[model samples]
Target: MAEMKTLTAAARSGTGKGAARSVRREGRIPGVIYGGGDAPEPIALDYRELNKLIYAGHFLTTIFELEVDGAKQRVIPRDYQLDPVKDQPLHVDFLRLKAGATLRVDVPVHFINQETCPGIKKGGLLNIVRHSVEMRVPADAIPDAIVADLGKLEINESLHISAVPLPDGCKPTQRDRDFTIASIAPPIAAPEEPGAAAAAAAAGKGGKGAPAAKAAPAAKAAPKPKK
Candidate 1:
């Protein structure tokens, strides 16, 4: 489960583009906390502190205890915007977490046991279909990732969502079909395809080994001198 962290913010009375720009000029990031039944609250966080947390990864999935005006509330980042050219954070939106509430999040997929997998041992490539799975889970007990085991997979065999165990209280939003997560793909050139790899390599060399076109029959030596 992802551990909740703490962040500090100052209450903001101002709103709109002009106000946000002013906040940025003062080395603070403009943001808002909404949802959970109460009205939206405007807030500002220290620029450097927020930037570090944003770049640390899993900013959206990780829950946070937001402290504003010395009062704390549980929340999770819903979205954020960045500058087009500079890539600096422009705005952020957070959602309040109510008791026993469930939140939808994209959890990362972690694969395991490649060393003992028969397909991998036989030179099969692990082709990942989904890097993450979107699921609804308890806000207080969000999972870190979904684990996919590759030990039982063979070449051309797939690992579906049903094959792996999901975290408790977490259910995938894709309930209609058992989606494929990963698979052991066969090698590009099978052993039966003799010289396929060699041919591909030669083709990469700009036709270096290819036979030249036979010179066109010499045009019959410019029509018979005997004529």
Candidate 2:
């Protein structure tokens, strides 16, 4: 189970790109909260606080308690827009949730026991195909991350998304196919052989010397004919 985060927010009286830019200039982030049969409410959050949550990698699935207009509301992050260059949060969309509501969220995957894996010990590379997976879990039962153990995986073996153990009442959105999450592949071998390369260079020089000797004989014959 994951711990819930509490954020303080204030209602925004002004809306529009200009107003949102102004809010950002004031060191705040513009956001909106919608769902639960209510109209969307425009809001602003402290940029510093929001940045901390983003850095913690908890903005997507963590349940948040938003203090809005002197009232506390439960919400989950639905969508977000980021500045391409600076990678800063530009806008955020929050979905209000009722108690006991089940929501679908993408949670990051964490792999364990890499050192104990025989394939990794034998110089195999671990490839992570999917960094996150989607699951339907109760708001309070959302996990911070899904853990997959690779202690017994051999070379060319894989751990699928279905192998991940989910908490009770939580289920993966994927079915009918066991999606590959991670795999161990053999290391790439070096292409060039040092000894073979040296031998080839010597053979090339010997062949060049033979051609030079034949050219010398031809030059001598031409001079004799001129005489």
Candidate 3:
């Protein structure tokens, strides 16, 4: 399960563009918390602190104990937006968690025993089909990642979602059929260097069509100066 994190936010009084812009001018990010049978609450987080956490990775999947004013709420980041030009956080949407609720999220895939993987040692490439998988998980028990074993996989063999074990009560979203997670692909032949084939053909023609070295017409015997 992913580790729990804590963050502090201040409740904002208003909503909409003007309010959000005003919050940003105060050097904080505007956000909202909704769901779990409650009215949405507008909130704000210190810009520097929010940027640090976002860069830490997996912010959406990581659960948080959010403290707004003096009260705490359990929540997860459902979504967030970034400025297209500046690439900075514009807003965040948090999903308030309630007891006995299940959530669908993309959990990262972790490959293990790669150094000893049969296919990799044999010059085969490990082609990843899915870096993360969406699964239905208990909100209180979300996993940080799922493991994919590669110790015994060989070239031309594929690893499917079924091969990896899931935590109890956790299920992949796709239940219809087994899906591929990764595969070991056969090595590809290196392409010949540019013009090498044509150069070889030219050299072969020269070998048969023209002598590499020609003897000068036998020099006429020195006309007998002696004769």
Candidate 4:
């Protein structure tokens, strides 16, 4: 289950870029909350606090309960914009989540027991195809991450979406095919030994089709002057 976080915000009466700029000048981030069958509400959050949360990571997957002017709104962060240069939070969008609502979100995939994987023990490489998967999950039951266990995987073997255990009422977005999540690739070739490589090179140096060194010119006949 996703852990819920709480944020405090204040209603903002103004709208548009100028108003948003004014809010930012005052050290606040302007944002909006919509959906859940209600009119969108404009609000502002403390810049420092919001920045901290944004950088801390996993802001989108976790649910946030926004306390806006004494009314608490349960929402999930859907989108956000950042300054291209500084990477600072510029604007945010939150979707108000009502009870029983379902959300389609990308949940990160976490590989476990990799050190104990049989394939890895045998010098095989683990190739990940999908780092995360899109899931349609209930708002209250969104998983923090999906686990992919590699302990028993063997070389040339693969794990598919159907093998993973998902939260109740959660389903993968890709239902048409059982897609591969990861695979154990064949081991990389070991480097040739220096002595062996040298021996092979020497053998091939004069092998078939190789041009032979030109014979030394025949010694000139002894000068006939003495005769």
**Best candidate (score: TM-score):** 4
Question: What local lDDT does model 1 show for residue 122?
Answer: 92
Q: Write the per-residue lDDT of candidate 3 for residues 1-227, one digit (tens) a residue.
A: 98889999999998999999999999999999999999999999999888888878989998999999999999999998888999889899999999999999999999998899999999999999999999999999999899999999999999999999999879999999999999999999899986898777777885553447866887677666773
Predictions in order: lDDT = 0.94, 0.88, 0.93, 0.94
For every model shown, the clashing-pair count is 0, 0, 0, 0
Q: All candidates' TM-scores?
A: 0.83, 0.80, 0.85, 0.87
TM-score of 4: 0.87
User: What pairs collide in candidate 2?
Assistant: none
- Estimate candidate 4's alpha-carbon lDDT, on a 0 to 1 scale: 0.94
lDDT of 4 by residue, 63-178 (tens): 99999999998999999999999999999999999999999999999999999999999999999999999999999988989999998999999999999988789999889999
Candidate 1 TM-score versus the reference: 0.83
Consecutive 10-residue window with the lowest summed lDDT within model 3: 206-215
Model 3, residue 212: C-alpha shift (Å): 9.3
Local error of candidate 4 at 15, Å? Answer: 1.4
Winner on lDDT between 1 and 3 is 1
Quick one: ranking by TM-score, best first? 4, 3, 1, 2
Q: After superposition, how far is residue 44 of candidate 2 from its true place, in Å?
A: 1.7
